[model samples]
Target chain A: MATTTVRLPRVLEPAVGAVREVTVSGATVQEALADLCAQHPTLTVRLFDEAGELRRHVLCIHNAQATRLTQPEPLADGDELAILPAVSGGSGDGRFEHRR
Target chain B: MTTLAVGTDKGAWLLHSDDQRSWAVDGPLFPGWGVTAFGRAADGTYLAATGSGWFGPGVHRSPDLHAWDQVAAGPAFGDSGPRLEQIWTFTTSLDGRVFCGVAEAGVFVSDDHGVTWEPLRAFNGHPTRAAWQPGAGGMCAHRVLLDGDRMWVAASAIGVFRSDDAGATFVPRNDGVEGAVPDGEPGIGYCVHAVVADPANADVIWRQDHKGVYRTDDGGDSWERIERGLPAGFGFPIARDDASGALFVVPLAADENRVPVDGRFAAWRSLDGGDSWSVAGKGWPDEPTYTSVLRGAIATDGDGGVYLGSTGGELWATADAGDTWQRLPGRYPRIATVALV
Candidate 1:
């Protein structure tokens, strides 16, 4: 089993013990995320969209390499994955911003 | 103990004030996330619905209103259907059940004091949803008014929906409400910004629509335009103090321009159930203003304690209906919603 360290965005710190670094075990990026979600169950809903797919705005970085939720490359032992959300404006104070 | 809970784009804060003149603030709890809605459960559990651009949406539960624990299994739309974007408003029923209105226009109920939630499928699967177009605020179920088995839900760009069987099934009740969409027309596409139900008489309901203000005496089966004594019609937030039978509304310029009416900031109130209105503008700044108060930003605590948060990040409190106002210290992120806990 490959042991990887995951980096989550600062915004997610409160849900995941306020830790910037989390050690997870997995051989692939998907597996690492599964382990990470297992460790922090509440993080599952935030990380995945309703289709059980990674949200379009979230970025999953694997050892300095960008990866998509649909297709994740293999991860090696001691790999570092960064999970962060795409930068965007606030959800509009309930007005002004157009909703999809 | 009157504690003002402010939900902002960045996080949530608690302002504890004994005299309503001075406040001791606490917060920024979910630091990087947006706090869309807040409420205190019937059991005294404080709940804040938070959403992150990166992490999605969840509920933060607190027993003492200070320290909170994020609950992961709050509400979800399975792996299909419309995505649950944000938790727009939270309503705690008289019996302690918590109901949360969410973006994508749906309702979820939590029996365990917001620890977990399940969708009200009947309302979500209503036939009108096919024609439910999103307003500028997205297709959000922003307001849920409950009175025993009868429940009413208001969504932006959608008219009021009523559920007589305890939210099991809902039917559109937009008889007198006007629609803003072209071919989309009336019924489902009518833009309703906010709604408040009379605590003394559940049959009486009021709405702040994109076009004008309306009141329904027969429980939303029909409505009557009640724009008397108002500067302009377009407004976002409308609330009422059940104890005193006083109604509150904030009128804006118009749909084309949503700033305060004529650059003045004031809340229009009606003591005799929307028959007429008077400006409750004491203690408010007379300077030209351009701020907008969102639908969920205005809340009434007990008899006449009115608390409002503006898009400009200012918190205003009025202890005596709107006779006078006091501004809370410090400016924070854009305010989305407010509640008295």
Candidate 2:
């Protein structure tokens, strides 16, 4: 049984907002994510899909580089994981502050 | 269950489900980018536009609605004239063509499924530079609707511009639309947000401007204020049912941009073509809910069903076009944008 740790960005830490870590064992990263998501149902919406497939826009980074090739795969022993959000916009708002 | 997408200033998410009682969600989306916009096409392809303040600009594309590919990454748009900088607003045409409305560079469009892009030559060269003043956030084309031969574009202070032949050209048309400051300053509107074009009617349009709700019957040629039953006509988003032209908007507090009195954070729908409205904030929080629904999000399904996710991390839905509202259980993901795609 291999175990891994996951870190979320500060902006995203509040999404789950509560108990941030769970221990899961899987041979591949997919199995590991499945285990993590299964342990924390509240983190479900922030993790997987209704069909059990990984949501495309969301990224799960194993170690430092992006996990583009190894999604839904098993995780190795002590591999660190990080979840990332998708930013969408163009240049314009930098000059003027958001006036609320 | 509706396959949902919620993008917040914090990040973006992809939600999926078939069992109405239960839904599956995934990702804070872009951790570094800070997602604000989500666009899903007909074939289930999803595009998330992120705004990485001081970091960089990027977009994520997911072919299967889950498990995305970092397909495009760069400075969102141009820095100054003819240059792209950090993107704040990303929109998609009905045909799934991607368009990014930048701050200084005017606008850019991607005909290659968001993988590549180009500039909007016309609006960028509108010849109305001096007259087209910048808004608080410099400016962006807040909302965009593509017509057969022209594109209807709305911004903060540049008023409105129309482009013919796929953003190849632009013309300004600002008549009947009015504005005022958030502090009731004399004549300060033009900070418009969401722009909706009736998929069925080319000329009819709806927008949630800075000060009021507006409708244009002659495309962007002219606009009329519609404020019959709204608590406050101004909001960040105005949603239209792609199938019915049913207009939906969240009312903000009149004096301040908070929840309107009576806990009516529910969405209002105008079936009589934007003339009158009714309350739909039943299950929505009643007080102190300052969830500023950002423009370009807050959408409805084909069933006249509306769904809104807020920066407040609350996901609320109405199965029957504001007849009633319900608060669904989900992450308080600071919904910067919402789509029932």
Candidate 3:
């Protein structure tokens, strides 16, 4: 398995000891997330939905490019996967604006 | 010292008071997350239900309210088609079973403290499931009341449902109530904001509905309007003081406005089982204050304390059964739920 680094958003730090990133081993994007969740189990619900699918608002970036969680793109030793909130539009007024 | 756990759209705060007048504020714990509800498990573990627009929902457990750790397996709807949006309320049975009412309108139970959860299929998959519609708050099973083997769940724009056989089956309990959506199924469109059962008699319950404030003596089989002192019956929360058998509700202008009547914020209290109501005691602001309290934002400490949090992020407390009111300091995000710990 290739060793990779998984970066989490600040809002999710509490679930993983307040760390910004973690090192995991996996062969693909999904496998790497599985490894990350295995290490920090609480992150599972935050990143994925009950159907085991990546949540609609969560985005996975691989090597500075947006990618799907189920993409089987092979991971290299230095590969980096970043979890970030998907930028979306909502109510223009801040009152009901969607969370970033 | 009496501590109040305030859950808001941003996080959670703990307000401590030694004499019910002066207070100390503790947090915005779980910063940036929407803390929806708070509950103490039968084992006394503090559970906070948190939701994120981007990351979905989660539950955190704490030995005390100070430090919390997220549960690995929280309440979820796995492969059930409907998305598990947010956990609205958590209710624990006398026998240690924990039940969670979640948005997307469903119920889940956990027998092992708050560690794991399983959905009650009978209630979740009712025959009226497809007809269930959401109010402006979105369809959510926001309230759950348990009376031994009988239980009630109130969902928005879907009225109330009762399970007489310990949640094995459920029946719609919206007779004599006006339907929010007129053209929908016969007994399915009544919008129920909140429900509080009489402490001494579970069969006697009070409800703050989209139509008006109502009370029922024969469980939920029938209801009668009970809005004497309330200016307008459009509001979100209805809380009952167990010790005094008093009921409380904050009436709003209308469903369209959703603010306090005439911009004056005051909670109406009923001492004689909701037969009539009056402005609950003094200390309300002299100026016009326009704010709304969500269904779960009002809570009573089994003794005589009643606390209310508003959508504007203000906190108010009444220490002597509404005889006197005080606005607690600190302005955070929109307050969602308040609980006395």
Candidate 4:
């Protein structure tokens, strides 16, 4: 098993005790995310849908490169995995604040 | 203490008052998420429904309204089923079963407070499932009302549904209501916005429809227009004060222009069980204030207290069941739902 770091955006920080980065061990991206969810069970719903697939609006990045969770790729120790939402913006009616 | 749990497009807030005269605000909890609905379990556990564009929908539980913990297993659909968009409303049954009304239009149930959930497939797969269409606000099951085995589920554009056998089956209850979509199936296209039933008699229910205001004494088998003093037939919310049996509605001009009639904002009240209506109370702004109240934005504390939040992010309260009003302090994101905790 490989130990890697997982990063999340601010919107998801609340589920992980307001922490942006977490460490887990897995051989592939899917396993790593599964491990992350096992530690913070609440993140399961936020990161994946009922079908056990990563939510379509969410993207997975590995070492600064876009990656798909479905296609399992071997992870190396100290590797970094980042989860981010798709870029979106529109006229604000004071309802939603755009965050980067 | 009187605390109003205010859910908004961005977060949730709790307004506390010792005597209902002076208020203190504490919130914006669950930051960056749309807190859509709030409810209390049979055991007094507070439940809040939250939705995110990227994270999907979830339910949070708390002993007090301030501290919340996300429930790992919330309401959800199957992999091939319609995507669960948002949790619109929650209704706790007499037997402690918690029912959740959700968008993409479906209902879910939780027996152990608000921790775990299972879809009510009978309602989700109603016989008219193929004919259900989205309203302007998206196809959403926004309200769930329960009276023993008789339950009502109201969805936008698709009208209201009644379940007589403990939710095992459901049928459309829009007999006397006008249809929103002309080409839709019989009894399936009525645009019902919100519904309030008589606490003493579940059959006697009031509805605020996209077409008009209506009431039914025969459990939705039929309906009659109740617009005697309403400015217009079109509006979004309908709330009832159980203590005084007073009914409330915020009438808008029409579906085409969803704003207060003539730029005036005031809640209309009917004292004789929705027979006749008039301006609810004093303290309404003298100047023109144009904004719409969402369906789930109005709530009653069951003891003469009524609270409402607006799309304009303002919160208003009535301690004496609409005899007078007071605007609470602080402006936040567009307010979506308010509950008396």
Candidate 5:
């Protein structure tokens, strides 16, 4: 069994938990996320949308290589995954703006 | 039985008060999720429409408002259709059919009281899909009103639509409303921010749109400008006092800046329907305040209480029909909607 470390950004830590890192076993990136979701069920909703797709604002990087929840790459033992929110300059122009 | 459900970007809260003065706040249900809208069923079941930056939209049903069970069946699209982005409104008809309006502009119904949802294909696959483009908030069907066999649905940037045979077929009803459309744009579809049907007269409907305030007396067959007494033309959250036929609206400055006019917070109210309006700002902050109220952030309890939630995370309540207001206790995430029960 391969053990991987998953780290959530500080902004999202409050939504899931204060703990930044969690370890899960998997041979591939998808397997690691499935195991991570099983260990922390609440994180599933925080990390993915209802369609089980990664939220639009969420970006995940695996072992320093950016990976999408829609298309995950394989993982290796001791690999690290980091999750962060997409950056944007919000506006109050009252013109319709995309939020999500 | 005076209860308020405040749906926020972070979670959902239930505020209860017996005399409309002291309130007891409960929960951050589905913590860290955005609760876009919620409603109470006839059998006292509370259904919350929630989504998040990491997760998409889903419905959570609560029997006692204390414990919630996420429903297995939620809004979904077929393999090739646009996905359901967010659940913008949850409503129950007199006949007990629960209806949910979602982004990508579609309606869904649950005859089993939120247990399962099926798309109202007539509205979803309407022939006007090509011309109905999304507004700033995306193509969302946010408001649903039912009167007998007649129903009204509001889709942003697409104007108002009416269905006489109960969601089977629909036709556009934007005869006199205005949109932010560019010059020479064909069709009359406009951005409708919020809409409320008259409790006493189903045919009388008031709307707060992207450009102005309007009223339709002929059940949306046509509409007329009703901003004669409003301070500004752009704002969200239009609610009505059911018992007295009084209407309320929060007016922001303009399309360029979506804050209250002059940086002051106030709610404009009309006693005799929409003939005229008066500003109500008593008990609000005197200092400069810059915040906008979203489409569903305002609600009336029908007795006398008027409640509004601001994007600034403040909850304001008026006990005597907007004559005076009081800021509620806590600081919450941006509020999406407030429901009074």
Candidate 6:
């Protein structure tokens, strides 16, 4: 069993209502994510693409360095992984709606 | 509901849209930096380039498309080399590699998502880095459109460059292009504003230069001028829809204005690739109000949505390939880059 810590941002910390950390397992990154999404069903659609595949845009980091989903990269015990979204240049006009 | 991640002067905003065009927004993330560029990866995540007005630049990411975090930060104006900097453009390849086009500097790639980065040394190392001159907006690496494994980047005065090895090295792609000759030479200046490869074809490509619109069927080896239907081919931005192979361009009515009829917006649509075109002003702005769309700011959402963000902070989107238009509310924060998220 591999144990890793996942972190959420402030905006999402609220949407998810409360900040909660969960554990997941598997040899591949996808397998680990599958377990995580299973525990936090709210993250299923955002964590994968239309085909339900994992992409780097989701920015899954294993132990500080980025992880390759295709490789047989294994997670270490007590290691930490981050599931981050790709942030691009954007702005908020006091006029439009702001969700998160 | 997919949110349209709009980068503007004030900050980063999310224009979220449901099935009925009922759009909502989230965040002006990084409150200070005016967002300049951003791209949502196939995995449905978003990456943003926060413009730090006078402070600096930084890159942020959100895996869930909602929450964002600053993974990396850039420099300020007097900071490209000696000072901090700003990221002019940000995009991700279908394969998920992140590329950021910076000012004064060149392209930077972050292979491990956006946690850390390595400058596209090949671009920053271009022999002409120092010699290359910035246009009206500074030497911002404009567009980094990825076609297959190859990548294309635009540098003002440095022209357009192609890297088949994925940002490793770059070579010029400016043959047969004309217009930006400084009123003398037959060649267009190295100031390329935007470039896009036909989503359906690897060989065909198009770019917007300071002088004229260009096309290349030989990867980036050679190009041809396609200025027959434009008031000025010396426009700044270009866009395309991968589904219909339909291309759309907004040429500034005047060489200097780049803001046709005084910012009265007009969209030029090319049907048979770039071989032919027709103008559509149904949803565009009217002239005399006087303004222009920014470089790399015109694009389609892949599902028939075409949008352009202007320096005026206006954002307009059309659902039917320019057939009709709808006005969204409000305006952009700063108006550097706009993308469908």
Q: DockQ values for all predictions?
A: 0.52, 0.04, 0.45, 0.39, 0.20, 0.02
Best by DockQ: 1
Docking quality tier of model 2? incorrect
- Give candidate 4 regions above 4 Å deviation: A68-70, A89-100
Question: CAPRI band of model 4?
Answer: acceptable
TM-score for candidate 5 (chain B): 0.97
Tens-digit per-residue lDDT, B159-238, candidate 3: 89999999999999989888899788977999899999986799998999999999999999999999887789888899
lDDT (tens digit, per residue) of candidate 2 on B1-341: 57777776566676777754466777756553456566654455676665443323355577865566544232233333433333555666777777777654367777777666677767766666545555654566656677666787777755667766667666666567775434333222366767777877878888777668898998767788998988887677787766555788877775254554454556777888899987753666656565656565576786767787765678877666666677666775456667765
* Alpha-carbon deviation at B1 in model 2, angstroms: 5.5
- Give the clashing residue pairs of candidate 1, or none: A42-B72, A46-B55
For B1-341, candidate 6 gives per-residue lDDT tens digits of: 65666776666666777762566767766554466678655555567765332223556678865677655222222223522235677777877777777765467776667766767778777765555655555566767778876877876656777778866678777776653436532332566777888777767888877777889999777888886777667566788877666788877765555557445566788877788777854856554545567775666878778877766777777777777766666766446667776
Q: What's the distance in Å from true for residue B105, model 1?
A: 0.5
RMSD of 2: 11.3
Candidate 3 docks with a DockQ of: 0.45
Candidate 3 stretches with Cα past 4 Å from truth are: A87-100
User: Model 1: runs farther than 4 Å from truth?
Assistant: A88-100, B183-186
DockQ score of the complex predicted as candidate 4: 0.39
Instruction: State the displacement of the C-alpha of residue B236, model 6, in Å, after optimal TM-score superposition.
Output: 1.7
Candidate 4 TM-score over all chains jointly = 0.94
**Whole-model alpha-carbon lDDT for candidate 2:** 0.62
